[model samples]
Target: EGIFELEYLDLEIGRCRILEPVKVKMVVAKTKEGFTVGGFVKTALEHPCTRCLKPVRLEINGVVEALYLPKNLASFKREKRLETLKNVIYYTGNIVDLSERIIEAIVVEIPQKVLCKPDCKGLCPYCGIDLNEHPDHVCDKISQESDIDPRFSVLMNLKKNEEEG
Candidate 1:
């Protein structure tokens, strides 16, 4: 079943189809001036979070629109052409392949980084352990004595002598 529907005056040039159920919505329209088409896409696919290696869900949504104009008028001069064309797609033939356009919109909407949750407790760097499940884990702690470097021992002795004096 299609996630969205398109009521087209001419079904020959345009039609609607759902690539992935509940994830993608495709619409195609054939106009006298040209062909206009668009789609709404979404994905809840699992991916590893950059901060934590835990699995996270990603959701994407976007709209893709295109227009098919006559080949002769393809080079029509218009201010802010690229920006205008971004919202209005151009085509030179009767049929426009909207697969790439729709996919591109969806791809751009995808998040660069996926987080498992807002406050995900990342893994412990020292022990290489997942901190989310083990809030009380203390194996990664460093002893106060062990944390002191030998180079600071001289400084500590000098400070002690000054205090005693």
Candidate 2:
């Protein structure tokens, strides 16, 4: 039962940025295999919105869990089992390294799709203008052209079914 505040963590995920200190609370217990570490992690991440390209800050809370195995066990049958498992780390010395486990915990909690707002209008396809700011925006070229795509023109007559008459 301990609390640790990490100023920053070295991670690269596109335009994502860690906006606040990473706070971790973990409990380590000695197990037959080695050690079991479980904790909670909290942090804030800033990422560009998917549609509008706006910076959006989101709070992340993740649960950390991992199994630490000794290097001596690597030579035996247990090593083969470790390869198929998730959140497992092999260590040699007395000091256990938790960096890899901590990063994994945080990453799993990150959201796949992030948006500034629920109904973000996004950008106009033709002009690349932020639609949220200008909802009524219209492109003259698109309006002048035929609304239907030529490739799908044959499907238009399927609705009338002239042969039925």
Candidate with top lDDT is: 2
> Model 2, 119: alpha-carbon shift in Å?
1.4
Q: Residues 84-145, candidate 2, lDDT per residue (tens digit)? A: 77877778888976766667777777677778998998988777899999999886656533
| lDDT by residue (tens digit), candidate 1, 34-151 | 6666667654444566666775555556766666566665577754644567556555655666556655665566567556887887887667677788878776353344655888
RMSD (Å) per prediction: 10.3, 5.3
TM-score of each model, paired residue for residue? 0.53, 0.71
lDDT of each: 0.59, 0.76
Off by over 4 Å in 2: 1-13, 79-85, 140-165
User: Per-residue lDDT for 121 in model 1?
Assistant: 78
> Which window of 10 residues has the lowest lDDT sum in candidate 1?
7-16
